[model samples]
Target: MFKKAFMSLALLLISALSWGQGNPVHFTVAQKQVSPSEVDVVFTGTINNGWHVYSTALPDGGPISASLNVEKAVGAKAEGPLRHSGKEINIDDPIFGMRVRYFEHHVQFVQRFKITGKTYSINGYLEYGTCNDEMCMPPQSVDFNYKGNGPKDAPAATDETAAATADDASPADSAAATPAGEAQDSVAAAAQAQPADTATASIGDQLWTPVIDKMKAYQPDTEGKSLWYIFLMGLLGGIIALFTPCVWPIIPMTVSFFLHRSGEKGKGVRDAIIYGISIIIIYMTLALVITALFGPQTLNEMSTNAPFNIFFFLLLVVFALSFFGMFELALPSSWGNKVDSKASATTGLLSIFLMAFTLSLVSFSCTAPVVGLLLVQAATSNNWVAPAIGMFGFALALALPFTLFAMFPSWMKKAPKSGSWMNTVKVVLGFVELAFSLKFFSVADLAYGWGLLDRETFLALWIAIFTLMGLYLLGILHFRSDGDNPKAQPVACIMLGLCSLAFAVYMVPGLWGAPCKAVSAFAPPMYTQDFNLNKTEEVKAKYTSYEEGMAAAKAQHKPVMLDFTGFGCVNCRKMEAAVWTDPEVQKRLNDDYVLISLYVDDKTPLAKPIEVKDSKGNTRKLRTVGDKWSWLEQTKFGYLAQPYYVTLDNNGMPLSGSFVYKEDIPGFLEFLDNGLKEYKKR
Candidate 1:
């Protein structure tokens, strides 16, 4: 049941832009005088590069097909069904998962009519759908008006002239006529071509002032905060490493070696500081090497790449099993020995650097997995410097104790002794690693369209892993490396075990589709659950189109919320699950504001493609709905990231500033409150 729900939700989310103000198909209407009482109405369209106009003979449930509608005809009787001419290509669309027929670059439609009066007029619209590889535009229509006067008492054409006329007729006249079944459908579609609603036209006429400058004031510190987060994660990993058996024992040994090597306390402290700095430099150098090898763009791709994510998932699982004492994973013993000997033979800064390298090699068994996890996370950040910054923080945390112990040697005696406790810590981390390994697998599973690790499955695994961890911590579970006395658990370990048990219990309700906001960032989306108690339909935007939504907002006298988001954006989901789930935020979003969620990754095309310039002044074509909104976010607010929120008045002027991905409810409440206040002021 959960698997079916996950597939349905994934399909809906995955199925759900284009810029610009350029019409993908430019239409021209011309009248070809065929005889004294007959004429051909030719509609020729020049489609833009990369854009395709669907054929009139398209299968049902496919894209909008080309059709000619005669809404009004004066003294003219329709003779036959409209005929179409174009190089129609039939191809299977991988994205839409359907076979479709469409025309590229050019197409033409012609309808012949029998004229019964000297003066006649015809007015109609040509409707079709256009799309490119990136995005699809909404159904588009082009209005065409034509008037013609037949010669007064004109003579009938001679056979030569008639033959010439037939030869010179538009290709659409000789093109394959619409099949009998589709011909009636085309006529019915033509009958439905109505003029634009006056009310919608008035809304379109309302001029919207650009709010880029106003929004610039509220551009949050995106990059700085992201790097800071990566650094903190690295630092936390390093601190965890300090409790491991391999690194914890060596800390006292390394500090004592530095202190004894120099009798003067100042010299020992200085040497230790240098050694810490050396460690930082060595790790940073490794980070740089990783950055150089993969590069930022490659790292970003690897983050979502199925194969890459799967490989990391397996690697992390192996690391977890090693932590559980199945086997030891370590660097070559010879490498550590060589580095230690080099440090002994060298002197000054080089000797200290070699000593740091030796320590790094020796502690690889415990440190490598942590560093690998850090690197994997940093890779997903899509920033070239993230790995280096994370490494700097990790190394700093790893080295801080060494420097401090050398400066105050007496403090070293107070440190916890290396014992079975260290092994216990390692085993607890193994549980953590096991839990986190699923996260990587989930990413791959999602990308590959594998429903194996749906929300319920993921939560079940996490609950089981953490429950086992809690049992191990409470001495209820035992491993080969565990201390002989199972009941001799420390108070701190017991507390941690209880917390883990509590957390596991907390996730139990999530299996039933409860909004477990705490773990939303790590778990699959709520839609993946077969039975969800929390209904988010009420919070979803009532209107998706910008113009339609803004028009409604104006009528309702409410502020507009331009929610710049994406289907695949993890942070956007986090914001929705965490912050938007708050009562106040939900109230304001539902009652006070008109939400227009613009998905930057939506593949649905625009009604008509437009040509515009990006920030870099390059000519860009808006082909899809995502492209259109993404362009708007970049051009109007100078932002290209997801989960961007901005409040605006009906006329589209900024009411407040823009907001990015932040989970702080109070801060977001302030943002919305300010927008309401500003709206009321004006």
Candidate 2:
């Protein structure tokens, strides 16, 4: 019986380990107001036996470090910086084969602030990572809020209630601080007496704000998503360009040249087949080399780096100008010319490959920018094979036409000739490139807290770009040709007019303060708008004080939805416009939810301690609302970009199977509804 019992216990241990594998990390936020002036924010992480949470401070080359952000009321001033207190654990990581120190069981981070107003609310989230002895789970975040009232509103003395709440210790008594309570109260009183003027200042008013805004503004909007979509977009772009004037004329000429060189339809067909394969191999190789060099982590880091974003913005602008006929981007003719000469001199497979390479190099002026754009997009994506897959799709699109036309040479007469219309197509794409360039600039602005471009400003710029593009399409504004005459073909005219009108309509609502939800991702926060229809009295009343709402959420045991979104996140806007509009999805989110929309790109700074540890493990004091959320996203979710949604139970535990993306709106809602059902059942 003893042996049997021991065997059963061992079996149970193995079962528990298997069950824990699917469990997510536990994240909780506990806030204490040390004084009227200062607040202490603590993040308590409980990892399963095998899992460990990294410290706010991590050594170089480790996974993302923990981070925090606080949103304070106007006139409040945060005192000192955020500090971490806990027993740090040292362990040897098998993955890196190095010893690393982190935290487990429980850890607390504290920040002190001075209040400047009679009343104010502080809000933000904690960003962190969870990894076990094995693999690391995706980074995640949990929202937190704390509110304080001024001395004038101190509660009347009540012996019974005082005793009941006596368990609450002053922030100063906490192990993290020696005299935290008195220091915090003094700061709060000072803030209340002389409200800080920094609240009203634009982001440019501060030096550090610009740095944070720059990082936020320039992050790539599309880095982590389905690979199929990236490849499909490239393929579609290629197909559309095939109809452009630059390459259309070559279709027939190239086929005729091959027919003459081969001397027969059968031989011409075979040569065309070989050329198509050669094109695929060449483009795929280029994509492979890029992926092999950069890797996913480096590519993801590039998505948020300010300098990279600025460079990309400038690069796209150059491409746009080139497309508008400012100048052509051509490869040195000597290289392609030499390859062409060799192809003529040689026969067989080597000749075929050389001829294919020559055609690609020779067409650099027309296809290079498009290819470059596609490659850049693919590189930023999460999938390792995305770049290669996208290039393969693009090459296929470019090659299929050549191969098909070769097989059916008699149908060549029906093909359209290259003409002025090709210039129009190039110019239209230029407008698109110019518009996309702004997105990068917006990321830089938000990351560094620069107030150069707000939601309205970004929308206004897009409106102008699309409006001008429409006019150009309708022959209103010509680059190479004259006046707005209706000389263009009927189909092209209608297509241009409709596209222009649609985009213009989209921008019009934005000016009026509509969520313009469709493009919310790319726009700045709605709060950044000088006027907003969505910010009505009803919305204001939903959460009058952070404390009350937090208490209620805790009592009810409902998962909180902390939405780190931005108006400038094109993906966020797309989600609002396309996904959230679905009736079923909308109802679930609006009715059974505690939705806290925290705009990471907002230029508004908090008056109190929005202190967070950056990915590097240094304490970062947040000045703007964006800084808080951005830090939270990076530290917790291991994500630096926006339109991120996180759900946590009242106790701050993430609901089982609760993480979701905007694209999976239906799934997201289902996940929430299922959680609600489970709660109700309990």
Candidate 3:
């Protein structure tokens, strides 16, 4: 009974340590430029994927921002505040209820201090904190040392001796607050007692191997649409617009004018085609001008921007209301009359071109909204030519009908009679506009991390909206324009109603925490699920932290499988949700080894920074939780990418092999079995 209880306790402890996010960060300081007059001190932080550290500014009660505190050196005077590159990310935390600014991936700081020709050594330290989706770590300080006449390729500017420690180290003074000499001594002494294999070791002249270079996986970008996709979307919008009441009637009138303008059939056909071409050129030129003025990135920024999204929400609402017969949005008749007079007064090609321009300006009320919608779509596409491509498609479809009917007037008889169906189409488009407007709200919800539009909430709202839309399609519901006695629904409306109903039914399981892969891209992540039925006896025998995991693995006389992974890593999650969830793989992982999962991108900082010299004698400061783990991986195995899996015996010696992103279950099983066999032999 005692042994069983101990085993259960051990399993629980081991399982808690394997949790991870991918971010790990390291800092290196250097001299950007050296001269007799002065030198530029540069500090660079190389942060791993999925994590971010605070910038040099933050509100009260928020995380600490990066700060550079330099100590006095003869013949040198520090100049200016530390200047960092990159636009600071200002985010409003839903949890903390405050705004914060941070830097991600990589950050650079430049500090220029005036100096004389006389030699001098400068010392300083940088203070910063890191955070990821999970949590935040306390701020840490990493010290640096620089020589006036240092070698061209001086190993590193960082001291590599002022590392974070278990105990507090008193700051030097108000101006230069690097830890005191006594504190550094104590830290070094304590570090000497640890095993050499550990990453946190203090003073050592240890032999080290070169880092093994490995190609990282090509992370797929989930944002933006393809250019061709944008063009097709614009084409779809144009086709829909062609059927609207505002533009359908103009087709016959425009074609009739071209036919009456000239008696020669060839001249009439040529003029009609030229008129259509003129419309295309006009719209395409407008699109180009918009792109040049606003720039492509501005559109991309507006896509997820909160204020812009809100503005869009309101604008779309107004458009939908207009379609619902709230009021007509029209251009002044005087403007149209003047353009018509210009067309009548002009002659030759100019007359035909003026007429085409007149139709565009006349149809602005109905076509403007559609054009604006297409341009907005183009902006979100992240393509330079998307706007132009969109306009080309829109203009092509808009102009084609007039040209075709003018060329062959007989086809005009086949055109569907413009009547009540046009209003139905408008009403249907209004419903679509209302439904999609919610997407901007969803983007705001995710960006601000607000719980207002959680997965279930968003899904529920969509289900209700689509259900109502389906009802309307079935003629069970009526809009403002519907007659007192509704006509039977058309086959087209019936088919759409069935699709909407089916989609709503499919989303029902998502309310109960289903994966909902079909709509996953639009919905919030699954972790937001407050209630889930799938939670049961599962793989819980993993570790969350390295020291605790190591202690347990050694006591249990089992090998350790170091799973280098990240929370923001999709492939890592895929492995967990798919491969690791396999019964055989779970059993093997649970029974065979102590799994110590470390996230290379975790932003949680250590209690203090750990400074160490690598094999090349370059001073590296490991500041965050991920930094410590990454240091171990690089030093021990000589590699720097996740999901790097290594099998280590109880004594922390490599047993069999290291694996990287082999997603197949059988392959992973073979790796585990081989490592276990090697461990048993040892």
* TM-score ranking, best first: 1, 3, 2
Q: Give one digit per residue, the lDDT tens place, for model 1 in 554-648.
A: 88999998888654344565577656866678999999999887756444545786787655687766655666666666666665555678899
Summing lDDT over every window of 10 consecutive residues in candidate 3, give the lowest-scoring window: 9-18
Best by lDDT: 1
- Stretches of candidate 1 above 4 Å error? 1-206, 535-548, 563-589, 596-646, 656-682
lDDT of each: 0.71, 0.58, 0.64
Better of 1 and 3 by lDDT: 1
In model 1, the worst 10-residue window by lDDT is: 9-18
Tell me how many clashing residue pairs each candidate has: 18, 65, 19
Alpha-carbon shift of residue 137 in model 3 (angstroms): 16
Q: For residues 1-682, could you state the per-residue lDDT of candidate 3 as single tens digits?
A: 3223322322211100112323367888877555655688887888654457777644433344576655444445565566788657886764334676778788887777655425556776777667544334334456777767544443434322222111112221221222223323433454464355543223221212322332122112312446667678878888888888888988888787778878766777888899989889888887776566553334444654566666566656666777777876676788779988988898988887888888777777566667666765665555667778888989988888878898898999999988777877777777777766676676667565666777688788878878887888887878877767778889999899889888889988888876565676566555455665545344543454566566678878888888876533334544565357556778778887888776554455578877888767978777566677667677766665556777777656666567665446666787789888988898
